[model samples]
Target: MAQSQPAQKYGPDLSVKLICPECQIPNPNVVEEFSSGDLVCGDCGLVLGDKVVDTRSEWRTFANDEGDDPSRVGAASNPLLDGVDEFETMISSRDGNSGISKELQRAAAKSSHGRSERSLMNAFRDISSMADQISLPRSIADIAKQLYKRVDEERLLRGKSTDAIIAACIFIACRQAGVPRTFKEVWGLTRVPKKVIGQCFKVLERAFGSNSPSMTPGVDTPTLNNVQSGPEDLMARYCNHLSLPVWLQSGAVDVAIAAREHGVLAGRSPITVAATCIYFSSALFGYPKSASEIGNIAGVGDSTIKSAYKILFNEKQPVLASIHDKRANVRNLPDP
Candidate 1:
């Protein structure tokens, strides 16, 4: 007679029983161990089964009050991937017995939609690379990306170069963020022609003009007056760049402000005005700087600085007189 195997313990509270056929007794004392993969009888010392399979939940939960929590199954999605959140299913080339044939995969690769998607992906990748090269913040990069998407949606890139448009978008984003980057800096980083970037910038400005509040969030929209930097805006920076004394810097700022109020800055670039202010203040304080030095610091030329200086000195005599009086008063005061 054959012996029957004892049932295994599937769980803490669940088990199975087998009758011992060799002993012809329904034995309740049965031990099923996994070390030798056998089922044996405890009372008769008989081996009833071998190579038995254990069936139970592999997930174990410690602490009777807690429930089982499984891990997430897939990778997280990215917004930069457009609308496609998951990888495209492709036919495996290594599996010869697979049901998906090679012809279908080849056809999918040659589709027009795939080509366009690839072009857009390449453009966005370039934008991100350019942004990082220029050390732009993540928020500005995201804004630039959104601007590029809008330009594409409007079909404005049909005749324009992609690199130029992306450069212009980054430039505008920097301006809106008040990052103080210049067109020359942007051009140097992107290697795009300055004229092309300017044209693209004009197009973007027209597209997101006063009516649209989309591009200039957290900042005032660009306007005719606010678009250009003022002489006062460039004064301190130019002074710092030249390493001038604090008194000279304050005097230069005063001269620039006076020039602005007297219409000396009308129809003139702020850089030239700032250079001229620094030059005039330097002369009055007996610590004069050359026009070339001032021009270099203020990003203008010597001739431009000379012309601005002539205009301010020839037209604004009272303002210079007031600055001279202030200097005299400071000189007359006793040392602290």
Candidate 2:
């Protein structure tokens, strides 16, 4: 027997040109009556169409505007995750006495939530927790979670250590947020080795399509660069850590900026540069902090601070001269 072709029933053509029957106007301005689902003519009241779909958001509210929406169907969707709703079917253990609970758990696992989705969910939770542990703001947590999602989706670091990836994401997120933290700071929170985090950071840098490309290892990669923080950015934080006055921070930042512009602080890391500036700035302000104290806060050794100070001493003339507005008096600044 030959297969019969299915008969096609003609339906109303929505795209067909509409005109007001009373006024005989072509393509008349049609207004939608959402309450009755009728499209009426704008110039003259005429029902051009009926039963049109309403395409507005389903936002319900209580008596208070946008508050306590009891009739709302579901909670807001997370911008970071893929699930339409975060309402997972969780099964209670019930003191390990209920077999039904285990059965429910297995059933829930087999439902819409797959292994990969669960992994992503766990990763996002961990990212938020880690951010909270370090007292980082919610914004940083969101950004890190986004980076983790991107790396996983793009397979940019396939077969790589998830811990390392998370650590790198945290580090990158901090730099991108303009609160540039040292790898040492990130390393303290995440026991992942600095070498591994650094490697992962490089891989992520390639993922960006050519914005903020300079990847100098020890330099302060600017905001959105996801590199390291510069000495200038670290000045206020270090000053606060050391209980130094505000003037000291301002002076130290100027020194770092001058050293950066003159290209004299190339070989030193940002931490070392920052430490040296604080030390020099402290001396100028008559509140000198011991090298060991500044080194302790900046996460560098005392010897490293001394070496940076020696280098600064050699280039002291231009570094001081380049300060904007002559903030630092050449006579007040001391020899390293």
Candidate 3:
């Protein structure tokens, strides 16, 4: 009776050359013969090796298999944590008999390492809360967290209030994301004064040097003035707050865009321009919101809105004429 050949194992894709001993071929094709568990010479079918092991991954799928397989073990680890991705310590609630001792817990709390860890945790928690309060997106929150981490790593938090540093980081993140939040708004939300936040922001920007994530490569750090909102950007938002009609809302946008196009908006605060646009558009459309009403919604004085409105109206006649023509055309359209 013929002896049974051992089953073969398949190896991964690899390019290798080996001489066949039996065939005496200089470089015989030595493919893994998986069915017989041997590495054999293709020319003579001579088994040169046996009992090979297949080291490929066991998880396999076919063309007809559903892609939503639930076999995944867990989420991928975050690289920021430096390989220690899980919590190493846990607090025990029970303090007597079967529980951890109070003295040990107290000692752990008093340690310098524990104090630093607690400070870091508290700062991050405050960042999350502030981000949520301001309705910031998750990407901005992540940027804030990254900035805070860098501050902590650089020991820049030594003499500064943690709250101030966190607020400053969030402010920078808001600017970087072009979210249009002002320092005044951040101060109102965080209760950290503007001066302290400003100082912290400057210190962080200095410490970050060329490595600052907020600064684009080859672009200088933007001044506070550069990041402020433009008139057109703020028009719709202020209009919405006042609950104006669609025509007035759209007219406000057109006024803002025209002012920008004609350079009438140069060196003007966007809030002021947006306020003026609202007041002007309301009057032009015959709904006529008061300067005081528009100013109150925009957080500017009525006098400022009035002054900006006159300048915009006088300097942008061509734009105003075009808008007037468009409105006349709309009114003349036959009702369906």
Candidate 4:
């Protein structure tokens, strides 16, 4: 069947030209005489529905209160296709861009918070105050700072308590700094609850690993002559006894010293003192004897030796040279 003819709709007059507010393009679908008042722009998507407006003539007035909304009035007055449109778009674009830029800046600021010097100083201050509050040794407090840096870099500490963090830092610093001390000794100085140091250290270790990558095995000038041996030293000596490299053997000695120092001066645990001494000796001197042998020499146990060695791996360099050399020939050693 053939389709019936449809009636024409009201539209703009053909003589009238309407421009799209958004694109500012001339409207092509405007009818010279229309049934309805609406006029749609063919070039752009702008739809003009007001019949009161002339189809053939240019419009200066707005559909609603043009002065009320600057954004809408601005767009209508200056279409996107014209120079006016460019200005309006630039303004609108700035609004969106500003919001995105603000969000990015906020994120960057948050990320940099932990890295700022202020943040580090704050952390140091907090730790120092905590040490004083708990009555931990000054050496232990200093060591704690080092450990805190390591932990912060590792991203393992998520706002843990100052007490917990201090204990962990102390334990790690003692081992690394060659300060052998016991949990009891630690408690005496820190005034923290028993085992808190060990427990928090375990958490830190599990999160950041039991060992640190930057740990060096050597003693400094001041600490070179300290013969306090810990299990770590015994372990180093044990490695040495097995014909380990000279560096390794020497490192074992440093580790032993660090462990021992931690126990005696830092941690203040006699049990750790003997154990650390034995372990370091075993590791550094190539002593093939088990922990039992070295522990016996130090008047401790095999378990203590093992535990002290475990602590030693995180120890820092103790003496740059052997104690015998430092005592005999101060000038003989190379300048650091």
lDDT of 1 by residue, 1-336 (tens): 999999976656445457776676754566887767888987787898899776645554344455634333445544655654344465667657664567767776676546656666667777888888867777777767777877887887578888899888887776665555557657877666788899998888777655333444576545322455556666767777788888788888887777776777567766667778888777766567788888776667899878777777676566755566656622221111
Q: Give Cα-based local distance difference scores for all models.
A: 0.69, 0.78, 0.71, 0.51
Query: TM-scores, in order shown?
Result: 0.55, 0.66, 0.58, 0.29
Error of 4 at 19 (Å): 96
Q: Give the C-alpha miss distance for residue 79 in model 4, angstroms.
A: 57
Off by over 4 Å in 4: 1-119, 126-143, 207-336
Best by TM-score: 2
lDDT tens digits by residue: candidate 4, 47-130: 655564545544344345555323333344311112222121111224554597666555654553344443555667667676
| TM-score of predicted structure 2 | 0.66
Q: Report per-prediction Cα RMSD to one decimal.
A: 15.6, 16.2, 13.1, 24.8
Q: Least accurate stretch of 10 residues (summed lDDT) in model 4?
A: 80-89
Model 3 per-residue lDDT at 229: 63
* 2 against 4, candidate with superior lDDT: 2
Q: Best by lDDT, which number?
A: 2
Candidate 2: Cα lDDT at 42 = 88
lDDT, candidate 2, 43-95, per-residue tens: 88888789989987777556666564455566667766764345545678894
TM-score of 1: 0.55
Preferred candidate (lDDT higher): 3 or 4: 3
Question: Clashes in candidate 1: how many?
Answer: 0
lDDT value for candidate 1? 0.69
